[model samples]
Target: MPGRALPVGLCPDMCPAAERDLRERERRLHRLELAPGCPGDPPRADPQRAVKEYSRPAAGKPRPPPSQLRPPPVLLATVRYLAGEVAESAGASPAEVVGFVADRLRAVRMDLALQAAGDAEATVVLEAALATLLAVVARLGPDDVRGPVDPVLLQTQVQESFGSLRRCYARGAGTRPRQAAFQGLFLLYNLGSVQALREVLQLPASLRACPALRTALAIDAAFREGNAARFFRLLRTLPYLQSCAVQGHVGLARRAALARLARALSTPKGQPLPLGFVVHLLALDGPQEARGLCQAHGLPVDEEGRVVFLRGRYAEEGRPPASACRVLVGSKLQGRTLEEVVMAEEEDEGVQAPRTMQEGDAPSPRVPGLAQTI
Candidate 1:
């Protein structure tokens, strides 16, 4: 009896093993409604737990385990279901499948730059998280989608969030339905990949049907390619970006750049502004007649609306045929009057006190008969 070991099951496993079992069982079981007496297994974080970990295989990394590729088909099937659900409920809950894909994707490698490791990691994690959304959306097509992944806050931790990306289901309990699709579109727009954009465009006609964001994306693409008319056309079509107040600065910037070019193109400039030459840059091939002129500092327009150039003057008679002084709007004269405009100096006069703010320098509030709104 002294030489023999206690029976395996009869022996005490000791403190360490017992403690581990105690810790592992700390989770609470999920309660079920339909099953009555049945208790669901406790939620175990394990791999699903968000962790700040990621790796890219050396120069040529080996493939991920078979489990990595498991999400595509399954998530794709869920998207197929969502296509019909939107008509009834806007979007169904198979969205859960997208979470399934997103949670695991955080483990995948991405082609991120090492120098900006933290920022890049943040971007990739969000991307992987959002990529799952695409699989579910792929079934609906791009037309039906409308909305952004994140709401515009006066201040947010980041323009888009990395945290929302780590968990596939932050949208689960109180998640908004159209949010995933809207976010997917925003991410796609910023990707800068024309081919990828085309892929996004291939989504269901329903998802693709939304012109609001699509119009904005089109404007962005046109601007990136430097196609002014296309950019203006898209802006005119949607009209939402004006209030987006989110990208207003960016919109104003592009408008300024294009306005300068339009001025040069319509005028008899002694020389052409170099950057303005690539009018067809964005693959937008339209004739000179197809172009329209907008006032300076004025929001761009396709119609003769209440828009006024910041100079607070009336819009010119439809981009004055073709002229020389039109090299750019003679905006330098906006707040000045002919009588007040400083002309030639009678050099013979010592009467010029150190030109202080004279009556001539005072700004006039309105320039009489201007038809435009500031």
Candidate 2:
């Protein structure tokens, strides 16, 4: 009676509203998984694979990830169908909306595991969530890094993995793990190629910077900031990074060419080929060097502890970020609207004033409200 507590009358009436809401949102996300393009929504454990258990220094035994609660692929693809849901509800970027929705969904996940306080499940869940969330950040953050992410719970493992990541992928060892780190993981370890990593990273990049690098500098930074599994895994891909560096540009693309040079000389993959064939090829330079390095050395991997490749798509399977709406237009006509534009019904385009460019190349009075370029 001395301390404040819920009034006796407030204790029982219905289920914990917060808990109930959490469960409901999770269920909704689950249902969305049944749709197309969402990856492994009702995730099944791989045939020969199981979630690995990690041992904490305090607890002598290994622990499994608690709340193995990865949201459905629709979570990401929500930008297609359920984006309005987030705009109506969260009203932020696709990543932010997803973050909000995921936050709520995770809340529900946490409630179920609420009693598992200070256990391995709790630690793994929190860590895995953070790692996965960063993967989302990579896909949604502003320009710089845009890449894949692998979550390794161990701090030391993160260090070791970071060493490997710098070696394997072309990157600086001391950077943050954001969009770029995630993108690198997507290509080398998870998605299996730089092309796909490019697509995902493009989701949040401001504009298309042509001829993508082997590993994004942003990625290098992220891994440094992330858990050890990422770092060590990165080390495995150094040779690929080196090859990109060696194949320098032929005078064009100063930024990209410089990035390539940095990758080659960064020193994570291995010692400089003071007299190595790869080094020699780099000196010769160009697309031919890239081709030569591959034929000569085979991407510097000798089949030791490779990431097996995950099949699911994170964005389509989970809640998409708020920014996703920018691209989700219904028809060429109305120019789709989210919450902010909800109150303003767009008028017919034909009725609008004729387009004209002013001195500053700004749209002239011919166009009144919308900003149009010549």
Candidate 3:
């Protein structure tokens, strides 16, 4: 076999198509050299050098001087406006006010996210904003908000905000007391959670010695031990904001305490317990609340305003009605506003350990060992 001729004016390796392809490949190689870090190019002497370089501005080009950036003026203005609205809008329905406050706070928080992380001035504004929001939330009652608020969601927001604030400022001596107080409030709000207790325990001894924290811990212990008398007593001693923080759990504690009473006091023969004694024991406002609590739990009240506990008749099916504790919490405020309450440093009013009742001093008639333990 012999080789065939290709085309006129073209050699085997010098066809017009091949020539054009060679020119195209050479153009690509030339471009690759101009493009930094292109594959198939020789490695640079400085292996760590950036692959791309940005040109400096021309001398005539206007440029901003390097200076500290601040939080947007609009953000601070919005926070102040919201705070003022919350504080001065007593005429507005609490639900409407709380809704506005919550929405504005969320927007403020998002705005804060875009700010520089190391901006201390911005962090201070954020802390103040969070405090104001938390104060507004803590002060409003469920009935006051009239179902506009999801308490659990609000609590989650509080937890997140507090965490962020702590990360930014908890180490500062000026903030340590406030942070400790907030921690105590958090612990009281989650009284039954083992994790909450563990976190409090992990805090420094000095912080744990904080009056609010110590009181909260004692209350937790009382609750775990099922000491209703001691629990209510400690609850009565909390500061206003702290009381507000734990108020949601009060009904639960009361129900649990009542159940314990029923278990201990129930007999084949019904026992009539005095409503006045219940009011004292549970730290209720009055005999009327005591009677109402008993009735709500399916316990009977006699004509004499005493609760009749019969083991067979007691019902444990329904949630207890919320008792009003405004008198208790309000008195503790001593005429402080919500902002003042939230920002105030806790005083060193020594926390007194609740005294254990002597066997003879048990106010209610107890079955030999059961009442002693309760």
RMSD of each: 24.5, 24.3, 21.5
Model 3 shows how many backbone clashes?
0
Local error of candidate 2 at 196, Å? Answer: 29
Give a tens-digit lDDT track for model 3, residues 1-374: 12532221111111123323443455422221123444543322221111111123457863312121123354455455556544446656655565556655664554445343344554555655665665566566648644767766677777776666656564444444365666777687788899889988988887787667778888888888778867887788777767767777788888888888888788777788888778877778888888888988888999998898888776766556766676556567676655554444556433444454455334343344444535
Clashes of each: 18, 58, 0
In the range 1-374, model 1's lDDT, one tens digit per residue, is 24533221111211123322343377421111012333445433222121212234566665333222223222222222222222123233333322332222333222121212233233333443333333332222122222222213211312223334423323344333343334334533343557546655655555444443344355455456554443433333221112121122233334444454444333332222222222222111222311332333232333423222333222333323221111111222345321111111112111111112123221123222211211
Model 3 / residue 167 / CA error / Å: 2.8
Top-down TM-score ranking: 3, 1, 2
- Global lDDT of each candidate: 0.30, 0.28, 0.61
Off by over 4 Å in 2: 1-93, 105-118, 141-374
Tell me the TM-score of each prediction against the true structure: 0.25, 0.22, 0.69
Model 1, residue 201: distance off in Å is 4.4
| Clash-forming residue pairs, model 3 | none
Error of 1 at 164 (Å): 2.2
Alpha carbon lDDT at 285, candidate 3: 84
Cα lDDT over the full model 3? 0.61
Better of 1 and 3 by lDDT: 3
